[model samples]
Target: MRIERLRATPVAVPYVHDEIWAFGRRRGQVSVLLEVETDEGVTGLGEAAAYPSADIVLAVLRSVEPLVLGEDPFAIERLMRRIELIGTWHHVKATSPAIAAVEMACWDIVGKVCGQPLVNLLGGRFRERVECFFYVARSDPAEVAREARRASESGFSTCYLKVGSDEPNTDIERVEALRDGAGPSARLRIDANEAWAPGTAVRMIRELARFDLELVEQPVSGRNLDELGYVRSRVEVPLLANEASWTRHEQLAVLKAGAADVLSVDNQMDGGLLNLKRSAGMCEAAGLPVVKHSLGELGVALAAAVHAIAATPNFTYANQAYGALLSDDITEGFGGGVAGYTDGHVDVPAEPGLGVTLDPDRVARYAELYRTEGAAFSFGDPDPVLRSPALPKF
Candidate 1:
C-alpha cells in the first residue's frame, strides 16, 4: 500500500527528578512522536528523541515529507535509500532521529501487514526480557546515596550516575556514596560525557575502582580514539563508547582503534532497527557487547529497541533507559517509568508492530505541556555557568 501522510506531535513528559549530566540538566524528556498512515488505512507509530533540539527534528520531518510521500511502506530499504542518497541526508548525522522515526514507522507497518511481532521479523527471540539500568540523577553525596538505595530497593541490579563535575573530588565522593548505598551486589556505572583528560581519566577511574564500577563511559573526549585507548589501557574498568560511536562508520573506526571494551549503539543515532541489528552483528563479530544508548526516549522508542534487543544476543549489559526518570508515559499501561518494568527488565510485547498503544489523552496532556513549558525539559542547564563548562575539567 502507498504511504499517505505523517502526523508529528511534540511532547514533553516530566521526569521524577531532573536528569543532571556534565553538560546540562533536563526536568524531563522531549520526544517527537510520529504516526504514519498508509493508503490501506494502516497506522504505524514511531518516536524520535529530540536530539540537539525538537525544532530541528520537526524541520527534518517537514523536509522529508516529499521524499517519503507516495512511497510503498513495505519498501523500507528503497524508501530509506531515497531519503538518504536522493534526500542527501547520509552525511548529516544530526537528522538521524527524524529519519529513524520515519523508518521505524515503516517497519511497524510491515509488521502489522505480516501479522507478526517485530521480534519475529528481525530474528527469533534470543531472550524473552530485556534488562535496563536505573538512571540516578546527579546530586550531592547524600542525595546520590539515597537515589542508589532507592534503585536497589526497586529491584534494579544496575544503577547509572553521571560524573565529571568541575571538582574531581566531588565526583569521587558521589561515586563512593553510591557504592555505599547500593551495597556490594549492585553494579555501578558512571558516564563522564567526555569531561576528563587522558591523565585525569586514568587517575579518576583508578580511584573510583575502589567502588568496583561495572563500567566507565566516555571519560576522555570521544573525538580522539587514541585518547579513549590511552585511558582504557591504563584503567582496569571497561570503557563504554558513546560519542565515539554514533554511526556505523564511527563504530568501525572505534573498533580499528581498539578504543573501547563495550560499545553503545542507538537506532535513533544511526538510522533505524535494521541498522541497530547491523550494529549488533558488527560488534558481535568483534566479540564485544553493545548497550543501547538513549537520547532520552519514551515508550514508543523504548519498545522498538526492546524487540531488537530481545531477539539479538550479545546485548550483554543492562542498557541505558529513562524509565527511572520519567514521571509518566503516554502509552496505555506499558512503558513509562519504573512501573513499566518488572524487576529492572522490560518484556517485549507479543502483539504486532511496536505493540504499544498511545493513550491519546496522555499524549494530548504532554503535548500541551510541550507547548506551554517546553524550554524546561530541553538539554540546557538553567544555570548559565553550568551550561558551558570547559571540557576536560581536571
Candidate 2:
C-alpha cells in the first residue's frame, strides 16, 4: 500500500516526577507523534524526541510532507535518503528526529502488511524479553538512594543515576548513598551528561570508583574525544559514550580513540531503528556491547525500542526506555500501556507493527496541552542549577 497521509501531532505529557539533569529540569515532556496512514487502511505510529524544542521537530516533519506523501511506505531507505539529501541541501540540523519518526512509522507499516512483528522483520528475536534499567533523576542523596532501593525492591537489577553536579563531593555522596541503598549487588550506572571538564571528570570518576559503578556515561563533553579517552584511561570503570557518538562515523571515531568501553545507542539520536541496528553491528564487530538510550520516550518510542532490542544480539547492558517515568502515555494494551516494563524487563510484543495500539482519547488530551500550554521548559532557558559551585579551599 502506498502512503496516503502523514499526521504529526505534538503532545505535552507530564512526567511522573521532575526530571532533573545537569542542563535543566523538566516537569513535563513534549514529543511529536507521527501517524502514517496507508491507502489500505493500515496506520502506523511513531514518536519523535522533542525535548529542548518540539516546534522545530514539528516544523521539520511538516517540511518533509511533500517528500513522503504518496510514496511507498516499504521504500524506507529511499525515503530516508531523499530526506537526508534535502536536509543536507537546506542545512537543516533538526531533521534526524523527524526523519526517525517517519522511518519508524514506515517500519510499523511494513510489519503490519507482512503480518509479522517488527523484531521478526528487523531480523528475528534475539531474546524473549529486553532488560531495562530504572532511571533515577538527580535529587537529594537520601531521595535518590530511596528511589534506588525502590527500584531494587521492585525487581530491577540495574538503576541509572543522573550525576555531574557542580559540587564534586555532592556527586560522590549521591553515588555512595545509592550504593548503600542498593545493597552492593545492584548495578548502578551514572550519566554525567557532559557536565564535567576533562580534569574534573578524571578526578571525579577516580573518587567515585570506591562505590563500584557499573559504568560512567559521557563524563566529559561529547565533542572532546581526547578528553573522554583520557578520562577513560584514568578510571577503572567502563566509560560509556552517550552524547559523544550518534552516527556510525562518530561511533567509529570513538572506538578508534579507545574512548569508551560501551556504546550507548539511542534510536532517536541515531535517526531510526535501522540506523541504530547498523551502529550496533559496528559496535559488535569492534567487540563492544551496545546499550539502548532513551530521551524521555513514551509508549510508541518505547515499543519501537523493545523491538530493536529484541533484534539486536550484542545489547548486553540494561536498556533505558524511560516509559515508566512518564505519568501517562498515548498508547495502550501492553504491560504498562504498551511501554511498561515488568520486573525490569519488557517482553517483545509478538503481534504485528510495533504490537501496540494508540489511545486516541489520551492522544487528543496531550495534543491539546501541546497546542495551548507548550513545553514546560526549553533547553535555551537558563540552565537549572542543582547545586552551586563550591568554595575554594586554601
Candidate 3:
C-alpha cells in the first residue's frame, strides 16, 4: 500500500514520580506519536521519544515527508535507505527517533496489510512474554527501600535504580536500602549514565558491588573505549554499554575495543526495529548478550519494542520500560503502568500489527497536557543551581 501522509503528535504524560538521573530530572515523558495513513485505508502507528527535543522530532517528520509520501510502506528497507542516504539523515544519530518512527509506522502497515502481528513478521515468537525491571526513580533511602520492597513483593525479579549522583556515598546508601527492601533475592541493577571517570568508576563500582549489583551500566564515559575497558577490567560487576552503543556502528566499535560485557540497544537510538534485531544478532555473534534501553517511552513505543524483543532470542535481561514511572498511558488496556503488567512481565500483543490500539480520548488529554505544562516535562534539568550539569563527578 502506498503511504498517504504522516501525522505527528507531541504529547506529554505525567510520571508517577519525577525520574532523577545523574545530570537531569523529568517529571514525565514526551513522545512524538506518528500515524502513517495509507491509500488503502490502512494506518500504521509509531512512537518516538522526544530524544533531543520534541521540536527536533517534529521538524524531522516535516523534512522527511517528501521522502516518505507515495512510497510503498511495505518496502521498509528501501524506504529507510532512501531516508538515510538520499535524505542525508544517516549520520545524524540524534535524528534517529523521527526516522525510526517512520520505519516503525511502515512495519505496522506491513503487518496490518499481511494480517500478521509484528512479532511474526520480525520472527515468530521466541518468547510469548517479556520480562521488565521495576524502575525505582532516585529518592531518599526510605523511599528507595519502599520502591524496592514493592517490586520484590510484586514478584519483579529485577529492580533498576539510578546511581552516579554527585555524592558517591549517597548512591551506596540507596543501593543498601534497595537491598534491604527488595531482599537478597532480587536482582539489583544500577545505571550511572556515563557520569564517572575511569578511576572513579572503578572505585565506586567496587564499593557498590558489595551490595550484589547484577550489572553496572555506562559507569565511565562512552566516547573513550579505552576508559570503558579500564573500568571493565577493574570491576567485578559486568558492564552494560548504553551511550557507548547507541548505533550499530558504535556497537561494532565497542565490540572491537572489548569495552563491555553486555550491550544495551534501542530502536529509537539506532533507526528501527530491524536495526534492533540486527544489533542483537551482532552482539550474539560476538558472544555477548543485549538488553533493551529506553529513553522513557510510553505505551505505543513500549508495545513496539516488546514485539521485536519477543521475536528475538538474546534479550536475556529484564528490558527497560517506563511502566513503573508513567501514571497513565494512551493505549487500550496494554502497557499502562503496574496495572498493565503481571509479575513484571508484559505479554506480547497477539493482535495484528502492534496488537495495541491508541485511545483517542487519552491522546487528546495528553496532547493538551503537552500544550499547557510541557516545559516541565522536557529532558532539560530545571534545577537552576545545577546549571549545565557536567559528568565525571568526582
Candidate 4:
C-alpha cells in the first residue's frame, strides 16, 4: 500500500530524576512522535529523541515526507535510499533521525500487515530476555552511593556511572562509593561520553581498574580511531564503543583494529533493526559482545531493542537497555514485557512480532498535548506547512 500522509507531533515528558551525563543535564524528555498513514488504513508509530526541542524534529519530518508520500511503504530499502539522498544536504543526525522515525513506523506497518512483530518481520528471536543496567544519575560520591544502594535494593543486577565528567579523583571517589554501596554482586559500567583526552582515559582506566568495572564506553573522542585503539591496548578495562561505531563498516573497522570489546548499538543511531543485526554480526564474527544503547527512547524502541538483542547470536553481554528505569512513559501499561533477568542475564520475548502494542488512548492524549505545544507556529508558514496537520489518518 502507498503511504498516504505523515505527521509529526511534539510532546514533553518529565524524567524520573535529574538526568546528568557527559552530554548534559536535563529534567525532562523533549521528543517528537512520528505517525504515518497508508492507503490500506494501516498506521504505525515511532519516536525520535529530539532533546533541546521538538521543532527540529518536526521540521525534519515535514521536509522529508514529500520524498516518500506516494511511495509503497513495503519498499523500505528504496524509501530509505531516497530519503538519504534528500538528507545529504542538511545536518546528518538531524535528518537521519527523522528518517529513522518514518522507517520504524513503516516496519511497524509491515509487521502489522504480516500479522507479526517487527523483530519477526526482520528475523527470529535468538533469546527471550535481554539483561539491563541502569545509568545512575548522581554526580557526587555520596549521592552516587545512595542511588547505587537504591538500585541494588530495587533488584537491578548492574548500574552504569557517568565517569570523566569531573576530575579523575572525583570520578574515582564516585566509583568507589558506588562499588561500596552496590557490593560485589551488582555489575558496574562507566560511560565518559568521550569526555576525556586519550591520556586521561588511559590514566582513569588504569586507576579505575581497581573498582572492577564491567566496561567503559567512549572514554575518548570517537574521531580518532588510532587513539581509541591505543587506549584499548594500554588499559585492562574493556572499551565499549558508542559514537565510534555507528554502522556495520565502522563496527568492523573498530573490531579489526581491536579498538573495542563491546559495542553500544542504539537502533535510532544505527539505522534500524536490519542494520543493527548486521553490526551485531560483525561483532559476532570478531568474537565481541553487543550491548543496546539508550537514547531516551520510549517503549517502542525499547521493545525493538529487546527483540534485536534477542535475535543477534553474538550479543552475549548485558547493557543499558533499562528504559523502564529512566522514563515516565505516556503509553502502554506499567512495565513493558521484560523476559526476566538473573545474575545480569536476560531472555527474549516468546510472543509474536515485537510482542508489544501501543496504547491508543495514551497516544491520543500525548498527541493532543503535542499539538497544543507546537501551535505557536502558523500553518501557512513554510516550517509548519512542511509538518502539515491536515495529513490523512488511518
List model 3 lDDT by residue over 183-244, tens digit each.
98899999999989888999999998889999999998989999999988888999999999
Give me candidate 2's TM-score against the actual structure. 0.93
For model 3, which pairs clash? none
lDDT score at residue 350, model 1, on the 0-100 scale? 86
- What ranges in model 2 sit over 4 Å off? 89-95, 335-339, 377-394
Q: What lDDT tens digits, residue by residue, belong to model 4 across residues 185-212?
A: 7789898888887887888899999999
Candidate 1: 10-residue stretch with minimal lDDT:
380-389
Q: Cα deviation of 259 in candidate 4 (Å)?
A: 1.3
Candidate 1 stretches greater than 4 Å from native: 384-387
Superposed on all Cα atoms, the candidates' RMSDs to the truth, in angstroms, are 1.1, 3.0, 1.1, 8.2
Better candidate by lDDT, 2 or 4? 2
Query: After best superposition, candidate 1 residue 378: deviation in angstroms?
Result: 0.7
Clashes of 2: 0
Angstrom error at residue 173, model 1: 0.8
Cα lDDT, model 4, residue 53: 50
Two-way lDDT contest, 2 vs 3, winner: 3
Model 2 agreement with the true structure over 126-245: per-residue lDDT tens digits: 898999888787579998888888788777888888887656788888898889878879999998888888878878888888888998999888887998888887889999998878
Q: Evaluate model 2: give its lDDT.
A: 0.81
